[model samples]
Target chain A: MQEKDIFNLLTDEGFCNYCLKTNADDVEYWENWLEEHPSERENIESQKNLIILLANETAAQVTQSEYQKLQRRIQLSKKNNRKIFPLIMRWAVAASLIISLSFGYYFYHKAQNNRQIATTISNKTAPGSTKAILILANGQKIELSAAANGTIATQSNTAIRKTNDGRIIYDGDSKSLLYNTTITPRGGKFDLTLADGTKVTLDAASSIKYPVSFTGKERKVEITGQVYFEVAHNAAKPFRVLTRGQTIEVLGTHFNINAYDDEPTIKTTLLEGKVSVNYLGINALLKPGEQASVKSGVSDIRVKAVDTELVIAWKNGLFRFSKTGLRSVMRQISRWYDMEIIYPETLKNTDLFEGSTPRSANVQSILRKLEVTGHVKFKVDGNKIIILNK
Target chain B: MKKGLDYINEWDAFVQAENEAAFHELYCHYFKYLSFIALKKGFPVNKVKDNINDLFLCLWEKKGQLNNVVNFHNYIVSSFLRKLYRKENLEIDESMFVETVPGLQTYPSVESQYIAQHTQDDLSRILKIFVEKLPDKQKQMIYQKFYLGLSYKEISETNSISINTVYNTIYKALEKLKIEIGKENLSAFSLALALLSLLCLIYFQKIS
Candidate 1:
């Protein structure tokens, strides 16, 4: 084969494809044929050299600066990657913190309003239910549950009267005074009148221990859970309420205490007269229609103006929900209608609703209204309401 | 066998550590011959140096992960060629290399072809400087075809250019390099060396 022939053979499209595509068998055949052609060997040799050279030529050089820059970029990217998780975690924590804080604050204010309403309504009607342990000053224990509904017993100096309103009142002609303690339980509410004629309304899941009769420098009560007070005027003896984590000192004032153990914060609302609230080592004197809150272990006390009717709505036999979530609404429902709440996962994301319903309204009616407004559905199974997805 | 594995592991650890001295030693040991092969394939000098530097850096990054690299010289040469072809955006069908050379009437047996063996050290400082001078595009094309061993079709596909254009540009670049390097009275060995070095340099410069 001439040089021209060899070049053409190497460069021919068909031959190139065959060589590139075929196996060792085909390559061997070509190798044998080329080996047999000794006369045109040099030409074949040069063509082979050119082919080899083409194959060998492949790599390109890079500049020092460019290489250094790429290395730097890769390193920087790796470093940045490490910070991503912490940054995301911080944002998540911050967002949840804000959300929980807002929710807690809103509920605190709302509960105060509910307590106010509950007090006003509770004073007007017969108390719904109560579990109060009556302790006479002489250390005699009378379980209120076992005693008759009215006028259980009387001390020699004081008249221990149980009114139709579920209050244990002491009506004394003289200035005789005696002390007693009434402790209420979960799913229980009660009313009482002190010897000084101070009216007290206790909410469900609550307790209050006070004097049966008054003839002292100060009228004081120790309480838990929730209660509304209408203290009789006593210029000398100031009325004081001691609860978990705080104290409320009043002078001829009407107020409420919400110190439920499950509750994250303690609340005190002043309805009328002067009262000083002390919480988390901080003290604030409150006028009527003012509420104070202490959250967690923090001493940050927040006082704000409030509507008195909304705060005391619960005592009025009305279920009031103000910007309340599904969980909170269900909790209230579970208590009132005496039902178990089972919520589906999807219902957890439901929007908050604010409204009021009479306690006389059945469970189904409240659920139906909620379904209409929030686009959620519920199934009533016996005493259990299963909240479902829309 | 365990001792061999341990040695390999140690070597990998050293590479991962980015010991510049070890890389420089490896360069000195193999770059000259590698540069020669690159130049013969028609890469410019600067490109050859750049390609070598990139390879070393890559090797360092993937130190412990390196495998199937029995012949470091051939591996580098092949790797360089592949990078060049990719850089130029060439789409050479790999199957073609196994096929016969196009436009040839007769071909020599593959065994008889004088494919120069490249060493790591052959790629040195002088070759790097030489490649730096070439135009960017020319350097890239030369590296793609020669160093990367990509076919014109692969180059075209990668670079988003016509196959015909890849061929013509490579042809033009080789011719220009041959003329430029021919002026020096370098030994035939160094001439071949210069050719490879220059091809890599020119190709890299062009692409960059």
Candidate 2:
């Protein structure tokens, strides 16, 4: 093959080991071919780099309104940055360390911030893109990210189709009652409509285990990480989300759950409907625009009025932090950006950040934002970002 | 060409919140430079906006530590570059040496250089033409694979197409780029075309 043929293959995206998902045969052939022509190795590698160069160059120019939107978000963050770390904020920090739940939902600033950060992969884990893995009831795993859209699989009595906008839809009878689990990896997100028209948006490093057909008396789905659910209303059949340490029952509602194990608390925020959160032996009813916090070692769940907009901002692609601690903020960043956060003794436990930036942004952009607060400094080294003393 | 010290000094001034004007000035000054870099790097417009915005936010968040930064420009640029690379690029020095091997047809340098040096406006104009010319399905496919970096399988599932179709669509688009870069036998002619495209891009960008 000509060197250009090799170039063509390298630029083809899935032709190398870096592609992550490759045909074993193609990998074998290329492995052998490169070995035979040792000299072509250098050229092949350069071609691969050239494709990256192309990919890097493909970033679109920023628009006027988008810039203005970020400007607003920054200013708002600046306002929050000055927050005095009052009792509520401290409580939030304490709660976050124990679980993912913090009633500390930053209030909706009511500011119009439509900042959208384009996902960049050069440093750290790229922000979650539209990808999900679907595990069938039979334990057959379908890489939903790669399958053909329509009816990729028929689990039990449900037909699963990936929509053009990258949503998985379940359409069919609920007679089978077989369970299917959808999981989003560390840097992935996907929109899902369950067997009963319930819309669920799974955030990065999250999963939802739901029955393909909800045949029983109640609709139950278990979740880990953060998931924004807009449950389809049915008076006869209530939707219940079984999360770590708690169970949330809703007649029909919109809510979000942050249930990652590393978080010190479990936060479930109700947006547009009435929901009841049961944690340990205690139960708390939540009204619209309220958040329930289930703190570690605490038997009761605390419910409070919250700005639903701020709590569910991830669904809209914004990272909204209000009086959020450095650690808490970085926790969100590390999960979304898929980077390990290394802190020097200085930033390990100092400062509170307040603001909103799009999760689609490059890690550096966000890091720079934090650095300018004058309380923190950052250095991005490969996939790990080290926090240095100023 | 301001020195890194000057940039750091300005960063300090802005971080201290002693001079909002200095902050705005710094933003205006680096906005174009970063935009040019990002646009030249082929980031789309809204992202260019977000990239700059996010950097500024980072500056604000880490302002307390601005005094520690020795090279603000390199710091910012490296940070932005970090956003682009999931893995390290092969050493260019090695490739540069390999390119000089006698009779080896290095994939035309004219295109690579031209590609890397485009201004935001120039790229926007060219992409407008290029993307508009593509069939809707192909355009969507290109955006999904190149912009979103979705796997072919993800794209196939999303677009309701076969995995081969997804691969072929991207393969064809990239092939067009290869052909465009390979059209002429004479290096001088290809260089001339690249320059001509640059000129046309600049001219078209100015008018539009």
Candidate 3:
């Protein structure tokens, strides 16, 4: 290839898709071309690096809120830098010994793809997309995904509109409070804006019920499965989320609630502002960056600090698993892929998955990653994923 | 101007004058690189983010001593790696003979072509067969040099092996991959030709 041709390839989106291995056809074409033109290897490599670097930098852009959190961490570390210098020195000496021993472990386990399995199948179960069902108070149903980008429905003088960008908005005023429920089936999700201006994102296999207008003293919504809320501030009226056995009351804040019935506990994670989580007559106040977990049939609510990003990873289009168990991981995959997981009762493993992947990945890609652990295997038969022990 | 020169200028401003803007520029430049590297090395994202902030804070505080550093890119990268792995001699002087102007932007892309594709399902299946067949020591050497983007000298230091062994292992493994891929493509080409000829025969028979 000519130098100019190489430059064109560097700037081409096809080349980027090849570099990231996102598109299979692009990858095949590039690999074949590289094999034919060995002389352009150096140029190809450098350009590929530039592409990856650019992509990485784009993915790593700190949001305005995240930047403030990072600045705080840096400030705290600066204050403790001097005091911790000698201590870090002593710890470094001890850590080096452990590191040397662990170096072999890290190397051996880094690329451990021992048992290769066939991943490419003719049919693929794609990841979830924007789709949901809206139920009006009068038992009328609107399939929001197929509805046009305009007023889909109206309830009590409130204009229910669907934006072109796939968001359901409730505009205008309502004299009477008529409730509406938005439900997302498996392999589907939807975004909604309540009359009070609270923005809500419904994850797959989830539902949220809210009023057409806030005529009462408070804005309340009941949710199932997982939902993220960014409440519009109203000092006079408190915003409340009723989920299963727990109730979360917030004055205007961002939070995520994972209250799937299959899950062991209903977790309400607060991202911004304050909230009070009530479970079984016990109330636990939560500050920003805190989580309140209410277990089934338990009288008390446990509060702890958590990484809110991981809590709302679904809303951000990411599957971030940090020491998450196999069963839990499979549950997430099942919801996203809309597949039934069939595993034997005798199948019990203690493998903790630790990785992150984009939610836009296919079922095979997700399963392939899990297979890299060498502890589990998956056989995708039509709409079912059968987990096998290694 | 090249990206390396931009990085070098930012490094100089931060080290010599303690310019906060330049320091922030350098931080933004390497933050994702370090974060991705740490994550690849199996560090949790939250911990990696915290460690990156701490690493930059310490480097900022100690910028006075960072002057006179010849390769600012290598210095910052190796320092972070050493701190991360808790090993002292993770530095690579093998690329010392190369022109210093090119800086850090060149090496990370060298062998990551295959390493970057290690995540794709089909590509990784092919890599698994070849990489799993290699000896343990050679596999580690290839991984350190290619996947981790470490230099030969750094690999030798990390694995306590000779630089010659690191070079030979990586070189042999890469050659094997090239040969294997070439042979596979040759077979695929022949198969395609055979199928095309068969189709031609069928067309001629139909016309006849």
Q: Highest lDDT: which candidate?
A: 3
Give the per-residue lDDT of model 3 (tens digit) for B1-208.
2333458878888888888888776776566456435544455445655667667767866789987776676456545654654432343221111112111233234444444554344333444565656665665554333333444455566556676666566556545654554555543333233223323322332233
Q: Of models 1 and 2, which has the larger DockQ? A: 1
DockQ of each: 0.04, 0.04, 0.04
Return the top candidate by DockQ. Answer: 1
- TM-score of every model versus the real structure: 0.41, 0.46, 0.48
| Worst window of 10 by summed lDDT in candidate 2 chain A | A107-116
C-alpha positional error of residue A17 in candidate 3 after TM-score superposition, expressed in Å: 46
Q: Write the per-residue lDDT of candidate 2 for residues A57-121, one digit (tens) a residue.
A: 34222222334675798779877767854766888888787664332232222222322222232
Comparing 1 and 3 on lDDT, the stronger one? 3
lDDT, residue A264, candidate 2: 84
* TM-score of candidate 2 chain A against the true chain A: 0.68
Superposed model 1: Cα runs more than 4 Å off? A1-150, A164-166, A173-179, A337-347, A379-386, B1-208
CA lDDT scores, all candidates in order? 0.59, 0.64, 0.69
Docking class of 3: incorrect
